[model samples]
Every structure is written in structure tokens, then in C-alpha cells.
Target: MAEWVERVDEQDEVLAVVDRAEAIRRRWLHRVATIVCRDRAGRILVHRRPDNMSRFAGQFNWMLGGATEAGESYEEAAARELSEELGVRGQPRFVLKFRCAGVVSPYWMGLHEVVVEDQVRPDPSEVAWHAWLTERELADLVRHEAFIPDAREAYDRYWATAANSKRP
Candidate 1:
């Protein structure tokens, strides 16, 4: 089983330490990633995490991503997750980072984006459903609290930066 590490609440300046294995087994202090993909129409791809997931099960979320391995770079972790969870190959662009505080399981999240033309084959164990949505649609979902809270800020950041960039 993978081990977990005690996470520092950087914003709150709180310090605590716990057994890594116990933390993960107990669903505490997880590290995760968010993958953002867009089509020619400028619609973003989102997916629902499998209900079997330990936290936020069945939650509508961004594309293929997950926890980072020990000593793995965030970029490498993102790429691996993109291929593993979505069965697609492409380089991922690092975009944003956020922390979600939980009573028992705080999460540190990394966000990445990639543009691709290949079809997606989501891993059933990881993803339950997926959809393509425009920025406006995503914003509406955020307004209604339909998406994962930890990912909303990253999504918004991606949307803003993507809109400003000249690259399609």
C-alpha cells in the first residue's frame, strides 16, 4: 500500500506529522492532480471520478489525473496519470496548484492541461463519466457547486489563461 505524509497547512501555518501509511489508509493528506483538455471548439473535457474512490466519489471533475508517486516530479506524475486514467498520450502543461483542507484528509492538488486530437478511453476504475463543456458551462457548474471544490480555482485559472493566450 502507498504511504502518506503529514501535510503542512501552509496558509494556516499549522504543522503536524503522522505515519504515511496510516494517513493514506485512513484517507488523510492525499496528493492529486487535475488534467484539463480542450477541443477545437474550445470546450473543456471533464469527468466524474468513480464512486469507488475514497474521497469525493462520483464527483464531476477534470480529466485524467491522480496522486503523485514518491520522488516523482509533478510534470511526470501528470503525464503518467493522463495516460493511465485516460489511455491517451500527450505532454501535459503545468498550470496551477491548490490545497483542500479536510478534517482528516487534506489534499494537495496539481493542475495540468493538454491539447489533443486522440480519442479518450477512460479507465473504468478511475472515471465514471465525462463531458465536454464551454467555459460558461463550467462557470455555471461552479456557481451551482457541481464540480470538485479543490479543482474550481485551477479550472478558473486555466480558463482565464487559455482565453488570453493566442494559441488555439
Candidate 2:
């Protein structure tokens, strides 16, 4: 089955609906929704992708997400991804968005934040390994581990935005 996605312009205005592979192959802009999952104690949920996956295989990522379906809002996509990938559901709060100079392909990434207080049943195909880590530990892994490039960029941007918002 083909994964269809909306190919958009720099501002993320839809130009056409195309296959995800074609969009990636052409480096066409598309929208991806991602969620930063955290526990009540504020530990981030980090997962490693399965080696069998086509993109970013065996890479670590702090966000659980995928390309948004045609006409789907970022919030909807984030919610769907949370359920599909981690068997957990909660209202994902919109945090930030930016155009990523992607390692694989360029795309508009909408980053959301959600707290998972329930037990997570990760799908093995989507997540090969999972752990909740402190912010300092996650920063260490991001600096030293084989994390996904796009996600690393997003993580930096997310924290940058958070820091800016906390200023007087």
C-alpha cells in the first residue's frame, strides 16, 4: 500500500497530493507531526526504530510520529501516531513547528508535547527499544548516540523555543 501525503510549498500550503516516497525522492515539502512524550515526573520517552524499517532504521528518536495524512491536522496526526506507535493516548499540546533541513528529505515538522501517565505498549515494528530518560540523560544520548538527524534538529528547536518563552 502506498502512503499518500500532501506536498506543500514553503508556507505549507498544499500544492498536490503525492506518494510519500515520491515526495521524499523529490525533496518536496510535506508536513510531519511529532509528539514529545513525557511521564508525570518529566522523563522523556525515547525509542529506537526497528532495523527493518526503511527510513532512519535503528536510529534513536525522542518523538513518536509520521507524515500527516492528506488534509489531516497536526494534532490529529500526533494523536494517531501516539496510539499506533505506543498504545497510549492523551491530548497532545501543540508546542512548535519548523522546516527541517532534513537528512532524508525536507519537510515541515509540527512538534507536540504529551504526557503519558498510562502504561505504554510499544509496537515492536515501530519501536525496537524504549526507555524514559531524564533531560540530562537524553541530552547525553543526543550528543553521543545514533539519533535521527531531523529529530535532533527538532529537539534543539523545541528547547530553544521553551527557553525563549520562559524569559521575563
Candidate 3:
């Protein structure tokens, strides 16, 4: 079954509903949710997109999430994605939302983070490989272009914020 997505304007106003494929093909601004899950050990969980994925195939990305469907809010989408893709449930802290000109399609992405002790069981179809990485290790992936491009943008902001918080 094909999935539907919410289309939005530059101001993030509801524009219309569209099939996910059509939206991607046209590079429309659609609602997407992304997560950065951290384990108690201070390591971040990262996963590789399946090789058969239409966009960013085989690229490593942070956490788990999917697009917000018609009439669903970003939080709802994030929570649902966590349950579906990671098999864990908890309130993820809202980080930020912004527009990204992604390689496949431009998107209005809502990013969140959660600290969890639950063992992550990433869905095989969505994630080909999963591992825990230190902040330095993750930063290396960004530098080497091993990470997904759009997600790299978000990670930059996330790391910047984290760095600031550590300032005395």
C-alpha cells in the first residue's frame, strides 16, 4: 500500500495531500520527523538505510523516524515511528524543525531526541545495520560523507547546541 504525506508551503502552511512517491519525485516540501536516540552510555545510535531504498540508499543516518501523514502532527509521527521502527516507546524531546533541500526531496523536518535504556531493535527493511557510536565517531562520519546529507545538516545544529551547553 502506498503512503500519503502532508504537503506544506514555505511558511509551513498546509498546502495539500500527496502520495509519498509523487511528493519525492516533485521535490515538494513535505513534513518529516527525524530522531537522534542516545543510550545511557552517552553513545548515539546510528543505522544504515537499506541498499534498496529509493533515496540515500546505504547511507548511515541517526535514529528512527518517518514522515508525518495527513492530519498528523510531528510529535505523533515521531512517536509512531519509534514504535514501528525501533520497538521502544517514550516521549522524545523536541529539538527543532526546519526546511532542508534534500537530495531526493526538500522537506520540513521535525527533529527530536530521546535518552533510552531500551535495546533498539531496528526494523530490517528500514535499517540494514545498527551500531552505537561516540560523538567523535559520529563527527567523523559527517566529515567523511558516510552520513546522509540532509541528516548531516541536522546533526551539525544538534552538535552545536550540545557544545554550547557544555560551555562554562
Number of the top TM-score candidate? 2
Winner by lDDT between candidate 2 and candidate 1: 2
Locate the minimum summed-lDDT window of 10 residues in model 3: 159-168
Please provide, for model 1 over 114-166, each residue's C-alpha lDDT reduced to its tens digit, 9 standing for 90 to 100: 87678989889988888888877777776556567666666666667767875
Give the CA lDDT, 0 to 100, for residue 71 in model 2.
85
Number of the top candidate by lDDT? 2
RMSD of each: 4.1, 1.5, 1.8
lDDT of 2 at 65: 96
Write out the backbone clash pairs for model 2: none
Per-model CA lDDT versus the true structure: 0.70, 0.93, 0.85
By the TM-score metric, which is better: model 1 or model 3? 3
Ranking by TM-score: 2, 3, 1
Q: What's model 1's TM-score?
A: 0.74
Worst 10 residues of 1 by lDDT: 5-14
Question: What does the lDDT read for residue 109 in candidate 1?
Answer: 68
What's the residue-level lDDT of 91 in candidate 1?
83
Each candidate structure's TM-score, on Cα atoms with residue i matched to residue i, is 0.74, 0.97, 0.92
lDDT of 2 by residue, 1-168 (tens): 889999999998999999999999999999999999999999999999999999889999999999999989999999999999999988899998899989889999999999899999999999999999999999999875589888889988988998999921
Return the lDDT, model 2, position 154: 90
